[model samples]
Target: MITTVTLNAAIDKTYVLSDFQLGKVSRIGQIHAVAGGKGINAARVLHQLGIRTLATGFVGGSNGDFILKNLDQQQISHDFVKVDDESRICLNIMNASNGESTELLEKGPLITEQQLAEFRQKIVLLGQQSRIVIFSGSIPAGLSTSVYAELIEALRKTNAAVFLDTSGDGLIHGLKAAPFFMKPNEDEIAQLTGKRPENETELVQSLHQLADSGIECASVSLGASGSMTVYKGTIYRVRVPSIEALNPVGSGDAYVAGMAAGIYQELPIEDCLRLAAACGTANALSAHAGFVKREDVDAFLKQIEIVQL
Candidate 1:
């Protein structure tokens, strides 16, 4: 079974408008609210793929009740530590005409030491039975940057593989623990490596450098250009063919979910990237997070071009 941890979960609200103007009233075309957090999103996708998943994290207050109810409505199993403060809400405003998106995210509830300790205990117990433990998203305030590293270390002792998807300090800290795989976008790669890549060759080289530092597998997401994955001294680039993009939000999460699923299923690395790209492309067809369909992934997987780099 796959276990996903979302330390900072939220109620995600997405609004669609034909033309968004500042200092003016605009009617919203559509609005959506769902369980929001990287790990939860991955678990949702994984569940839809027919994988057994358990989501764990910290949540509290009436907002926490809403999250719990929503997960129950979706029939997703979860275990969360109750906290004092209310969980956050994230706002995504999508431009209907231009296919553009703007995100307004709120910092999540501050976790107390006692509550965090309980959360860790729950994860340690879950680790004993989980095959793949995915540590994703941000660490809320009051948690050390090395929190994920610490979690990975615990999961390692239990013989569960770790897949980390985070950025900046979280990425650096998690790398020290040497996760089985990591999915960082280009901007995150720049932040970690200091030197930025101007092209795909340079980016592959940088990915190699990161792998040299002890990371087992690394994939740098290049947005519309698709993504590049480096594993076992070989570099593979999966290019996303041009399509009428409806929404780009959650594509990276879909990619991570695909990669995690592939790793869990013991598929080839190239196949993993193909599934990753396919999931991402499927995500672009819908505005909701974790909205990719199995049929869409199957269809897109056939068209993805994977090149040796």
Candidate 2:
């Protein structure tokens, strides 16, 4: 089974409107809400892919309850530590006129020290039962940036392959644990290496730098241009067929889910990239975050091209 960690889980609310004006009232055309946060999103996609997945993280209050209920309704298994504070709500306002999206993110609840300890213990225990443990998204307030590093190190006793998808100091410190895989976008790569890559050559160089630091595989997502991945000193470039994207919010999480599914199945590295890219593209074609139709993935897979670079 694959285990996913979301330190700060949330209720994601998407509002669709014809136009959004600053300091003006706008009538909503539609509203969609779901259990979200990077790991939860990935878990949802994994479940859709027929993978056995368990989501672990911190949640509390009514929003937390809603999150858990939504997961159960979706038939996604989850075990989360209950906190005293309330989970956050993330709002996504989509403008129908020009397909622009505006996001308002909450900082989430503060976790107490006791709560943190409980989660650490729970994750390590779950890690033992998992073949792949994914640590994703942002850490809540009051947690140190080294949280992922500490948890990943604790999981070293288990046989689980760790996949990390996060940003900022979390990514920096998590690298010390040398996770099995990581997918960072261009800005995130720059955040870790302290240099923004200007072109494909520079991007590949950055990936090489990450591999030298002990990470086994690192993929840099290039949005519609597809992605570039480095695995065990070899580089591969992936390209995906373009389509009109309905919503690209959780595409990254979907990508992580596909890669995790591929690795868990012991597929070849090239095949893993193919699946990952397809899942990401499929998510973009859907209106919901972290959602993909199985048929879409299969069709996109045939169109995705991968070249060894």
Candidate 3:
């Protein structure tokens, strides 16, 4: 089973509009809400793909209860520690005018030291059930940036493979623990490496350097251009067939889930990357977060092109 950790969980509110206009009245076509976070999205995708997954993290207040109830209804198993402050909410505005999206996010609740300790205990207890641990999203306020790093160290004791996806100091500290893999978008990779890739070659080289930075594997997601994965000193670029794009959000999390699934199956890195591209592109053709269809993934997999860099 795969375990996912979402340090900052939120209630996701999505508004679909016919057209988003500046300083003008807008009509909402649809509204959807769900329990969401990067790790939660990954776990949801994995579960949809018939993979066993367990999600855990911090939650509190009415919003937290709502999140838990939603997860329970979805039948997605989760173990979250209760806290004092309420969890956060994220607004996803989908503009039909140009099919663009704008996101407004609230910083999550501040986790107390006692609450964090309880969370660590939960992790220790769950660590025995999962072969892989997925660490995603940002750390909440009042938590140390090294929180994931510390968790990585503890999970390492069980010989569980840990995959991380985050940015800034959280990523920096996590890297010190040397995870099994990481999937960072291009911008996050640039910020971490301090060298933006102007071209494909530069980008491939940058990914390789990340592997050298102690991570066993480093894959960079390039949105419509697909993604690139570096493994065993080799760089492979995977491309997805273009389609009528619906939304770009949650594509990265889908890709991570795909890759994690492939890794768990012991597939070749190239095939794993193909699965990742299929998952990401399938997500782009949907409206909801991590709402990619398995049929779409299967259809897109046939068109995925992979080339060695």
Candidate 4:
């Protein structure tokens, strides 16, 4: 089974408006809310892909209750550590006419040291049962940047391979644990290597540098342009066909889910990249975050082109 970690889970609400103008009282056309956070989003995608996934993290209060209920309604399994503080609520205001989205994020509840310890113990047990343990998203307010690194090190005792998807210092510190796989976008890649890649050539070079640092696999997401991935000392460029994107919020998480699913099935590197790209593209076509129909993935898979770089 795959285990996903979401330390700062939240209820993601998307408000669709005909004309979302700032400083104006706009009428909401529609609203969609779901259990979210990078890992939860990925878990939801994994579940849709017929994968056995267990989501674990911190949650609390009415918002947290709503998150759990939503997950239950979706038939997604979860085991979260409850806290006294309320979980966060993130808003995505979508402009229906222009297809543009603006996001307002909240810093989640403060986690006590005791709660953090309990979570670590839980991960140790979950890691033992999981084939792949994914650490995603930001750490909560009270946790240090080294949290993922610490957890990854603890999970090292288990047989599970670690897949990390995060940004900033969390990504920097998590690198110390040498996870098996990581997917960072272009800007994140620049932050890690301290060099802004001018083009795909430079991006491939950055990926190779990451590989040299003991990471088994690394991929740099290029939004609509697709991605560049490196596995087993080889770089592959993934090309995704354009589509009318309804909401692209969780495309990255969907890509991670697809990659993890492929790895769990032990598919070839090329096939894995194809699946990952297809899932990401499929996510853009959907209105919900981290959601994709299996048929959409299959159709997109046939259209994706991967070439060796």
Query: Candidate 2: where are CA atoms >4 Å away?
Result: none
| CA deviation > 4 Å runs, candidate 3 | none
- Residue-by-residue lDDT tens digits, candidate 1, 218-243: 89988788999888878888898787
Each candidate structure's TM-score, on Cα atoms with residue i matched to residue i, is 0.97, 0.99, 0.97, 0.99
lDDT minimum window of 10 residues, candidate 3: 152-161
Q: Write the per-residue lDDT of candidate 3 for residues 207-253, one digit (tens) a residue.
A: 87888888888899999988888888888888889788988788998
Candidate 2 accuracy as lDDT: 0.94
Worst 10 residues of 2 by lDDT: 94-103
The weakest ten consecutive residues by lDDT in model 4 span 196-205
Candidate 2, residue 229: Cα displacement in angstroms equals 0.4
The count of residue-pair clashes in candidate 4 stands at 0
Reference-based lDDT, residue 180, model 2: 96
Judge candidate 3 at residue 217 and give its lDDT: 86
Relative to the true structure, candidate 3 reaches a TM of 0.97
Residue-level lDDT of model 2, residues 20-56, one tens digit each, is 8889999898999999999999999999999999999
* lDDT per model vs. reference: 0.86, 0.94, 0.88, 0.94
User: What is the TM-score of candidate 4?
Assistant: 0.99
Candidate with better TM-score, 3 vs 4: 4
